[model samples]
Target: MPGSTDERRAAGYRPLLFSIAYGMTGSVGDAEDLVQDAFLGLTRARQEGTEIVDPKAYLTTAVTRLGINYLRSARVRRETYVGNWLPEPVVLPTDRPGPAEHAELADSLSMAFLVLLEALSPVERAVFMLREVFGYGYAEVARATGKTEANCRQIFARARQRVAAGGQMIAFRSSPPERRAEGEQLARRFFAAAAGGDMNALLGMLAPNVALHVDTGGKAQAFGKPLAGRLPVVRLLLGVFRRAGILGVCLRPAWVNGRPGAVKFDADGSVTGVIELDITDGMVQAIHSVANPDKLAHIRLNPNEA
Candidate 1:
């Protein structure tokens, strides 16, 4: 019975540790691997009778250290990566996430939010996550992250300033019923035009300063960098779709990360990518094309709707 309870405690560490590494790395795959590694380390400690009175804190520290190391070595790590990059967006059960879980999931994992976090150093990121998301005090964050209270406070202040500059909200709950329906119709029209290779039709709906981001992860060719301006993005998308000549790529409108999104599906029904749209004033402001197959595992689509 004691052993079973210990195992359950060890298992519970995953969500907490994943929240840590995923908050820093923003890559679900890497976050899961980090949690697994942290648990393995814990397992070893338990075997050796090191005794974990607070497994969550212990694993959070371990995962944060791993993320710190990853950030320190990110340039080298990206050298051999598959392609152009972005973090894998996490999707949590929002309707029932409640206040605690919603706050936990929201502050810990949104793509736009995490991008702001990327601006911080690994230790700073750890400090920010602990202090802001986990509700830890400066003293506790300092202890957890192995920093002095003063340094942790400074880091937290800096992070707060940067995050404020980003002008992002704490939560982006999916559009309400009526608004969502309207948005879905708009998404459907735009997606159909793009998928059908209608450059003019697609461009008509885009804002003059629309931006597009393609994440091929180096596996497939994509825009080497972010493409800005509506004309340029329209041209780029037109060129790619025209060149590929693949037919029947359908996008089903869905809510991912509490925003308007669509999943790309091939004729044979496999998910090829997820395209998340950010809109302002009825025009597409930003387009996030998530093409890393490894990352889209959490997204689901219905063929009947497609």
Candidate 2:
């Protein structure tokens, strides 16, 4: 067995470290890589005879700074991205734990919430996630962010204010399995109407102000901007269905970010794109379609499950 310190550092804290990094970067692969790097850095510090008073604090600080640096580099790339960019979707288990167990984690894991975080600066985003989602105190957040406690508080306040003002605070709670089933049903009905070009049926399921945002990364065909209102979105989707030619294209419903979503598959069964719906009061409020090949690289669509 490994030593006690190794067990504590590697096993006890790895998940929390990953959560922090993911909240910052919104990329599962990048978060895992950053956590691994943090662990390796800790090993190097120990080997070099660096006196560590608190391993948890040291690791948190290292990971936060690393994530901040990574986000700064990533933002430059996003600036040139085609269409309305979205965070890479993360599929969650259908049988999720109760809200009492992982309520905050579930709250922050939604694609909409992650997209909201994109509006913040790197340091501001880090401060907000640490304080709001993880419930870290100002002192701890300050230590992790390498800022004064006052500065950290100011940053968090500013971030909260900006996010609230942006009106992107729609919270996706951890619902019971039956609620998920309802969402899946809604998605099925909507897509069926879309596939059949039933304008009346599709309009009945959409919110009056339903918004559609598609990201193709300039690699595929998509609108240059987001489409607003129900009728236009319905028409655009119908146009898309007509344009796809239907020879080998398939659409399947799956659970995306803990909500019902659909995937586009080629005849050979590879995933080509993903569509996540924000359903509110049994109506689709927003449609997020990501066809960016680079973003879809990590998504695996299971046709047999939702």
Candidate 3:
């Protein structure tokens, strides 16, 4: 019974651990690896007759430490990235499927918030995600990161302040049906405008200060820097549409990290890239496009669903 109980507990906490890892690293692949490594550590401990007083706490700490280390090393690669480094987009299930389906949790999982998390140091990111996003206490966060409670409190305070300074605060909650429908409509219009190369229509829908972040990872063709201002962004989009017209690729709306976005597909129906827009005040504020082939392996585009 005790063994079964331990197994159940491990299984129950896995999603939570995965959320924490993904929150810190912003890569589903990295998060999965970190979570698996943590569980493997737990199994090794059990085999060596080590008793874990609180398996959840132990596992959380393991995952956090692993995430911190991974981030530290991954920073070098990110620095060398070809262009703007956007977080890997992950699909969120529509229906409430598990304990991870809380509205606040949904908010934190957005690509925007994950991009902000990049501003924090590895330890600070872990502390902020554990304490603020996941609702862990100072004591728990401290244990997870091997920091004193006072140090963790300071780290979280600093991290929160840095995130707040990143323009506007994102409301981390699931959109109601009506609001979601509105956003979907806006996304559809924007997609159509881009597809038709209607620069004026796209300009009307874009906020004056709209910026575009594109990640090509040196594997695809993209701008070397983030494109800012409406004119520049519109010109870039028009050029892209013209090129897509020649190449026989088309844009179809899809959900990118729970937000309405478009995916690019070649004539053979293989995905070329995914684009996500951040909307505010009925206008597009920011656009994030990820064209890195390695980062898109987790997403399977349904050719028929559009």
Question: Candidate 2 clash total?
Answer: 0
lDDT of 2 by residue, 56-126 (tens): 88889989999999999998787887778887766544444332212224435667778888889999999
lDDT of 1 by residue, 1-306 (tens): 238887886676566677677777877677778878888888888888887887777777788888888777875665576655667855432233422322344333445566667667778788888877777888778767788999888898988787777665443334457765565567778877876778888888888877787777775667677888978888787766565456766666654444566767777888787776766566777787888777777544444442
Q: lDDT by residue for model 3 over 1-306, one digit each (tens)?
A: 248878987878877888788888888788888889998999899888888889899999999999999999999888887777887776433333323422223445667778888888999999989987788999999999999999999998999999999857665556777777777789899988888888889999999999898887888877787899999999999888888889999777766666768778888888788888787668888899988988878766645445
lDDT of each: 0.69, 0.79, 0.81
Ranking by lDDT: 3, 2, 1
Clashing pairs in 2: none
What is the TM-score ranking, best to worst?
3, 2, 1
Model 3: CA > 4 A from native: 92-106
Per-prediction TM-score: 0.74, 0.87, 0.89
Q: Give stretches of model 2 more than 4 Å off.
A: 1-5, 50-55, 93-107, 176-178, 242-245, 301-306
Q: In model 1, which runs have C-alpha deviations exceeding 4 angstroms?
A: 1-3, 79-84, 91-108, 162-208, 234-246, 279-283, 292-306
Report the Cα lDDT for residue 189, model 3. Answer: 93
TM-score of 3: 0.89
Compute the lDDT of residue 8 as modeled in candidate 3: 81
- Give the Cα error of residue 138 in candidate 1, in Å: 2.0
